[model samples]
Target: MAIKNVVVAGGSGALGTPIVNELVKSGFNVTVLSREGSTTTQPAGTTVKHVDYKSVDSLKAAIAGQDAVVSVLGSFAIPEQIPLAQAAFAPGSTIKRFIPSEFGVNTRKTPGSAIGKILGAKTQLVDFLTEEANKNPNFKWTGISNGHFFDWGLSRGLFGLDREKRTAKIYDSGNERFQASNLPFVAKAVSAVLQKADTPDDKTANQYFEIASFTPTQNEVLAAAEELTGGDKWTVNRVSSAEVQKVAEDKLSKGDYSVFVDLLSVWQYADGAGHAPNLADPALGNNILGLGHQDVKESVAAWLKE
Candidate 1:
């Protein structure tokens, strides 16, 4: 099936915007379903549709006739999986494929650790889609596990680095390497997956697709930054994984969900302990996606320029 038309829920947000832009650049007709009165700009050749997440009918109408739906919508209060499933399986709908807001770790396989607790809600979303796919043969879903957001984390200071201060607090030896993907790389992966929606033999349904750039350690990232900046102007501090996990557990015990989630992400890959099992898929990792090791120094240089 040729997926020419795509609908992106929460397309106005930070991550979704890039995905939508990439899809548009790839010649896919894109539509963005956002909250009513949303002021976010839509990429050229993409339409913005107003649809409330809570309204099944609104969502169904917005998703109608689309070959694929890419959802990056998230809310701390609500699990969006239900609405997404509803829209995909709406009565007489033609939606063939669905990509949930799974842009982090492999929550479905690893659900007991700190990352598990933080991403437990996302697991529920995945389970919802699993059941839906069982009930509807035409319904299929893909989960993108890209380890960490490489460029965004550095530029926006997401991984605890003060971009202005050029300082980062490291965990463990900072020598553990894990795969990371830039936001644009993530967007390209989504576009590739949508482009080949009919190849069910690929076993993409209810399956996790691991997408990554070069797997590098925290020390490596810091070194790249230093090399790019031409000095040791950045300060790197060390923290134990056990200490970070303890703090995450404490926050969860205190009902601070936001801090708990952040800590969970820290515990998942702080020491590069978590491995992407699905990177072995040649179709996803090599042939089809053609994802290769990206230069950290070059990536950081581009980010610093921006």
Candidate 2:
């Protein structure tokens, strides 16, 4: 069946706005499902549907008649899986596709790591979605794993880099390259997926699709920053994997996300060395998604301007 209308839960968020705009540009009648009382404005031609994440009835109403659903919805409070499953399996729905908010790290592979431990709840969401898809053939789900949001991380200090000082904290020797994607790349890939919904050759029912822009090392990032800023005036601080792991352990003992930090620490050291073979889907590489290789130097220059 051809996908015509699509819905996005949490469509008012930072990532959701771009996804909504891209979907609308691709000719899908887009519906933005915001939580009730959300103050964010919807884009033109996109309908705003108020749905409470806690209320299954409200979610079902907003999700009705959509060909597919995309969720960028997240919370440090609510377990997202329940609402996501409810929205996917909304009453009298023919919703064929679902894209979960699995946009960071290859969760399926890093099972025993700090991130895996900290994100145990999110992992359960994946398991639930898989089980749901298996039980109901009418529904399908895709988890897009884009390693880390490169530009977003850089801008937001997520990589422990100070944008003003042009300084970053590194793990190990900081020479290992790791995969990363920009927020725009993630939005484009998601939009491309929804636009090409009928063409299932590049998609699976309940599987993960990994995408990346550049796999640059921390040193390479520093070099790129220096080049972009017109000088080598940046600071680089190094931390060992063991130190990171110990910190993560201490944090986890205190019931925090130190585990996730540790996992990220391990990721810095391991790169893609310990990842699964099919983690990056070449079939969905550059063709269906229009995903092109990004220039890190140019991107950094632009970011510095912003």
Candidate 3:
């Protein structure tokens, strides 16, 4: 029904921490579950529980009285969510809503490519949660598929512009428009979804919601960077999206795990244009969620200034 007591797994992580803060600020009773041996401290005004992640019983006990379970596990730790999901929707559980850890691109529309392999676990979890929700009338799930984390990309040299190196690798003509959201916007989206969970006009139940702060092309991002840095021309390199996907696939086949950057480029430029699967969706849930909009130029200027 109305999601009040909420449990967040991996609440100390980069994206997870912000989501926790927003949920707390929104006045949702928050509980963070860390691994049994984790030394990280939980944020103030929330309860913390250390439990064995591998045990469904331990997870069930920690989340016994919660109304919703929001998971923020990273890619590597995604498999651990299976037990958590099982615990949340277990027979006689109080949990009504389950928000899985899918804070990136809409993998439901993901093409058959390297990025799909990287997101296989996420897709599996979505399917599992959907099936579980279908079986239980009271249980529902929501997936927030924000295109890309914009702020993180800017600071971490994603989107192919390395300000430090004054170098750029613009994807195919660099004119593809794809969805991207700042980290805090994503957190706000989550809080908004939870706030409307029990409303009469609830649109979040058993659905995958897509949101983005801004949808900008690679060239536009470069332009913003150039404008911010007084129009310094970046050393540019161009690569085909297909070739980048092939490279990432080849590297992954060889056990190299550093292919995510290439895969990100491939996802953005998958159609040889800026056609991210999420952007192609007919219905974007930004308006439905009451989330704030962010402009790319302002975001770039602020992040670059930092």
Among the numbered candidates, top TM-score falls to 3
Q: Give the Å error, residue 199, model 3.
A: 2.2
Q: What is the TM-score of each candidate against the true structure?
A: 0.90, 0.89, 0.94
Q: Give the per-residue lDDT digits (tens) of candidate 1, residues 68-177.
A: 88888765523765786788887698888889888866566668765566677788888888888898898888888776788877777766566567788777887766
Worst-scoring 10-residue span by lDDT in model 3: 273-282
* Two-way TM-score contest, 1 vs 2, winner: 1
Pick the winner on lDDT between candidates 1 and 3.
3
When summed lDDT is taken over every stretch of 10 residues in candidate 2, the lowest stretch is 271-280
Tens digit of lDDT per residue, candidate 3, span 16-96?
Answer: 999999999999999999998888997799999998888999999999989999999988899999999999999989988
The reply for model 2, stretches above 4 Å from the true place, is 200-202, 258-265, 269-290
Q: Which is superior by lDDT, 2 or 3? A: 3
Q: How accurate is candidate 3 locally (lDDT)?
A: 0.85
lDDT of 2: 0.73
Question: What's the lDDT for residue 101 in model 2?
Answer: 76
Backbone clash tally for model 3?
A: 1
Please state the error at residue 88 of candidate 2 in Å.
Answer: 1.9
Per-candidate Cα lDDT values, in order, are 0.75, 0.73, 0.85
Report the CA-based lDDT of candidate 1 relative to the real structure: 0.75
Instruction: Write the number of the candidate with greater TM-score, choosing between 2 and 3.
Output: 3
User: Which tens-of-lDDT digit does each residue in 1-306 have in candidate 2?
Assistant: 378888888777667778888888878899887767888889899998877788777777778878888878764622754775777776577788888777777678767766667667667788888888888878788888777777777777777667787788877777676768887788888877776665645455566776777767777777777777777667778777776677777787788753664567566555345442232456644433667667777777777888
